[model samples]
Target chain A: MSVVYGRVALIGLGLIASSMAWGMRRAGLAEEIVGTARSAQTRETAREIGLCDRVVDTAAEAVKDADLVVLAVPVGVMGAVAEEIGPHLKQGATVSDVGSVKRAVIAAVGPHIPDGVNFIPAHPLAGTEHSGPRSGFAELFDNRFCLLVPAENSDRQAVDRLRAYWEGLGANVEEMDADHHDLVLAVTSHAPHLIAYTMVGVADDLRRVTDSEVIKYSAAGFRDFTRIAASDPTMWRDVFLTNKDATLEILGRFTEELFALQRAIRTGDGDMLFDYFTRTRAIRRSIIDAGQDTDAPDFGRSKVHP
Target chain B: MSVVYGRVALIGLGLIASSMAWGMRRAGLAEEIVGTARSAQTRETAREIGLCDRVVDTAAEAVKDADLVVLAVPVGVMGAVAEEIGPHLKQGATVSDVGSVKRAVIAAVGPHIPDGVNFIPAHPLAGTEHSGPRSGFAELFDNRFCLLVPAENSDRQAVDRLRAYWEGLGANVEEMDADHHDLVLAVTSHAPHLIAYTMVGVADDLRRVTDSEVIKYSAAGFRDFTRIAASDPTMWRDVFLTNKDATLEILGRFTEELFALQRAIRTGDGDMLFDYFTRTRAIRRSIIDAGQDTDAPDFGRSKVHP
Candidate 1:
């Protein structure tokens, strides 16, 4: 748990980057943390909040001589950021990313990595609706699963070091092939988001017909969809764009099943509705049993910190 | 706030009935809260937990001399229960119900109400995924909205009295025609439930293909669907069957929008995806601003006390 990386450079100062910085400091995993943001205002704000040991003018300068360089940019910008840091990354330095889509990030950042640096593409399946440097906390990675999608012939020593780094920050790590990772995440995150966005859009358009009725009675269940749909537009846009194939695959299955349910509703098949509802209830129970989610519907109604 | 109804009776005690009983007692809105269930075991459990003042054997007995008879039964059973309690309901009594579908409940129960009795259908826009008497809490109605779908030519006094009773329980009250209420709720509750149920069914079937990856990597947002799908099967079965028209209407609209998004994803139309995502995000923010939902993306982080 001692400082493993003397200099840990975070390329983006968003929620993931700031949270990792907090975790690094809290766990004493990094002696110095350097960060860079595209906008001067965010860099200034990140510095004001003490999100890192040093704030840099460019990705290359931030990552220069750093023992571990983390790419936390949008998926669309991963290639450019990787190219910027490729020449300056220290020898044998471990390079990693925290993007939602794994395949696209690997494709974009893979070529830019210096041969000596370990390019480990990891996605920590943890986040809040909030974003930006000021929004992170130390325990954000606690008990969360982080999937590392490394090349088949990735250096074991580099992989082990990166594993140790995430473990030190309190994340449980597993490794998978990049395509399988995308497919798994397509079912878990990407399709759910698109469906949520679709439903929210429908509800919004229906508001034109129903006026404020959607907002008024939303406490029933539509409210939750709204929250999921309210995710960062730019981030989700990139996720859909980068994770297109897998997302489309799952969405196809989803729409097919939705059509079946729609037919059941149209045909007055109550039993079909009941059976589907009953089966889904067990899945929620399984998630709770797996220790991934809480059994209580609303986080046990826990109080929020002021 | 004086007692608005003396000798109040509730038939078919489940989430809504039990919650109504608890809230009525807490607010002193009912002089005596009597209840009836189909089985003696439930009656005993209801009495043991103080869910009702007097647990009765028959719906008819429970309704005798009651100034307000709240039919909190399954949509499918509304007719039978109304017929049984029709003769015993006291003259000048106000009869209201807390069923999801207003038009169906009215059609089932309308003929049974005597000339002097007023049948004011209501859909209380409140509940948790949990069911049964033990799940009930007095504060479940606090800050929630209640829709009173009063029958045409309904008694004004009875409507006002019921409104006062609900207000005493800390709910905002609105009046809508039974048909309109069913349509509005079909969008907010029924359609959402069907979609959740269908998605959960899809995931459950994918268990073999995805193995435990579905639960382990559920952080991607599939967990929310599980929670929504875990709601009571009987209640939702009844919702779909009773509100078929509105649910189907909304389902058609949802499918169309989902298809548009799916096509965008299939064609790599980032502009369309971004626009849909951005539009949905605004609706979510509006719902939060309207106070219908918390800003929390994961309600599991919430500490909502029952």
Candidate 2:
């Protein structure tokens, strides 16, 4: 309810940063929110939408004298953004990033941090397929988990302050080591996203099943893959590139499992397919029970559309 | 609306059948609906919920004097249900089905239709992961598609009446041949379901990533796969077994495309990955434009949850 930071700097005006700005204002978590993006159009759009208290022209200008600076850029560009704003950061300012991958982010942004500045890597496990400034809302982070990956020698006060700030923005924050966080996300997010992209691509490339037919009959199941596959391309490309090792491991496992299921289907092994399907259903139940997803049928879309 | 059928018998009491019952009642499309199921508990649930005008204990009893008999059972069990009810069907009654795989259902149920009894196969492209009589909703077919696969010599009047009945139930109707219907569904529904099941199983089998972690962080994109994987096991198992060839073909294509994407990720070929992802996004746009899915971010869960 109170200000967690006197001044907050958001270095990318994409979905995450725009959402953070809206959520921060909703909870009065920051006295002043300054935002900037690499693209002039994005910066102009943010200003036009009143997304931040101050829409600066550059990351350097945005981070100047800010008590907390968050880099919400794609993983590939975190280093450049950090180098640009490093000198402008105020003394005792905490530097953090909302990148999907933490180990790569820490590696890229760690060197630019000054002696008194704290650099903590955090990933908010929340997003929609839609991207950009206009696609964000305050409820994006509500009831979602935000993992904070802080170094061993990081300042405790700074880490706690960042945790409080995210909590104020309606996220449940938990501390995770960089390596474990990457592996966990590889299984839960990266691998699944790549698989969805692959399936959607295959559907599109099939000559026999016309594109119109694919789109028209999508509600049977493929539409869900399209939704996941529609996520920001550059962001996801960086995710796969930076988190390559862990993601490849998960994909290897996924391919092996998929081949086995395909074999079962080919061999008419009904029991294997049935057992696998039954086991996976339990995990869905656990997700609903954990409050990570809605139990309403069809993700409660019937309610939304009706 | 006037009654489309004087008496309609539903041979299976699952999500599709129950939903049809509710939709029929909502539109007054059927004067009297008779339903039956293999499991006593399902029949009990249907009776308790008043899912039909009458709940019979056997498929034979349910089809007696019925003007339209719909075999709403699993793909694998369609033949047996058809055989059981064939003798009891009225002389001029029309026999239809709501199976996922049209060719297989046609093969399985075709031989049993006595002369003068019209046999037309239909598949409705609508459902949720939830199953059972209680999961049925009148609006389940609203704005969804229903494909009709009538035999070459089939009675034209019977097919027209069935199309009108589905239209009254709030679905758009289309005529598709059984073979093309099978292939289209293999790409859109069956293969997608198998891939989702495989991904969920891989996540569950990975001991390194605890189940709690997957459940907690599923909002990152994996939850959609879980929803698809949570569909009724028996129905999906039958779908895979009956539509084996087409599904295997699609899976082959999916695996090949996935390998290409994986190679790009391994080689750090960002352009290839980005291009593939961008193309997939266009298909998602088409699906949205076609009204096959909701465009709301996160499928509009934020609104439902907030």
Candidate 3:
């Protein structure tokens, strides 16, 4: 395909940005790609790996003369980076972000957009436990859902162009309201991550189990929680903090349901446990049917088994 | 790789027993693997799949003259199957089980064992989300832990033979006491499974999020919980019913720790959240380093990327 934008700027050189660089290059989504990071070490790594067409020293420098600019930094720093790059954003350029929490990101970065710049917030529901510049590949976003949150009264052509660009990068783009996106993400990602983190922490704090035993026997179930818990701490921290109310709401529901199941176990309610488990199995079937996850047993990790 | 047992009787033809059939055949651990299931359909499937050397119609017929008899049924039914097979067990035979909960299985099955017969309960800490006769594989036990819980006065020779057989099946065998084994399994498998089930149930119960949204966006984190929660309903129900005290205890601790983290989130304690998450990250590294799980990104599901 042809270039979706004359030039694209990435304000962070982490997993998402590096992946975007490779994916965009693979599909020829942009004529030129400029990237920057707050950490000099990250910038050096990106440059050494040739993550983008040009590695700049600042977000402002990266945004200059760019037709499309994506803020791929942590949620906590979105506003600061937006403020720094707002004036440098070229007129008529479309500015988008890849933050997980949409409402908070829109609230944080929307004000800093210049008059002629269109700000769109997009989040791709895809990732691995690994992070940073070297941990990304071009297929990271392939067939993954990328939710686009465009402001009311925004430029229609720009939104369409950004959606096309995401399609070019191999993601299925769908428009969603920022608030609904946060709520959906809270249920699907944020609360589950917190629960995994909590379970892993509980295992770690148990003195009788011993860390070695936990590590050795983790294949039974606990290792999946550990993988989710091992995701980048800072990014997750910002996710929970920014998506606070929705996450807490879902978690509250989780605790209530957990208590009910605990009561069933205590009361020896075999039928209740069986019915609940049976219902949850259907959802897994639907996930596989939707092409969102693999139906291969154990998430296809059997290949890794010794 | 010589025959460890002249004839091994598997009392059930489910995932564990079927996998044991393949694993034993792969290593020639048993001269003959005779199997039976309470369900005729399961027995037919076993016959169709060649899951055993001989597929008998009853536990009694399967255990006749067998050197090693393994009760590979659900934990809640151990007593009945043990009672049925006890009188038929050979005088010098070894009768063991692959139940997840040791204390309960030992308590239920011990009194039924006849004189001169050895009763050793074992639990293989390995499985997948799939079940039934067709889901079995030769490598299901490969490098996974198999905990052996021998009675205080059990025969040393029988126990050693059983351990060797499991090793030949590609598992690392460890000897543990019954009560301790239950508690350890509660922490590693039972509690995590309950949490996953609870979390998945909550997501399904959420009316506002919609089922399709949860299934589509699930790759973020919820898919892992769903995969775990999709485990065989009957087996998990029996597991919770049999291992009640320890599972409830670990879950109690899990809820306590989760509440603390929730409080931190509510109070905007970023340091506490970050520190807890960072600490959990080390556990994943240890699990991977110990070779219990793969460190490849997304558990190496990247290969399935579209």
Provide the overall lDDT of each model, using Cα atoms, as 2-decimal numbers.
0.83, 0.90, 0.89
Interface DockQ of candidate 1:
0.67
lDDT of 3 at B218: 90
Taking the tens digit of each residue's C-alpha lDDT, what string does model 2 give over A1-306? 999999999999898999899899889999999999989999999999999998988999999989999999999999998888888889899999899999999899999998899888899988878789887788778878999999999999999999999999888999999999999999999999999999999999999999999999998999899999999999999999999999999999999998999999989999999999999999999999998777764452232211
lDDT of 2 by residue, B22-109 (tens): 8999899988999999999999999998999999899999999999999988889889888888888899999999999988888889
Identify the runs in model 2 with alpha carbons over 4 angstroms from their true place. Answer: A297-306, B297-306
Write down the TM-score for model 1: 0.96
- List each candidate's DockQ score: 0.67, 0.66, 0.63
User: Could you tell me the TM-score of chain A in candidate 2?
Assistant: 0.97
Error of 1 at B122 (Å): 0.7
TM-score of each: 0.96, 0.97, 0.97
Q: Among these predicted structures, which one has the highest DockQ?
A: 1
Which DockQ-derived CAPRI band holds candidate 2?
Answer: medium
Ranking by DockQ: 1, 2, 3
Better candidate number, 1 or 2, judged by TM-score: 2
Model 1 CA deviation exceeding 4 Å by range: A207-211, A300-306, B207-211, B296-303
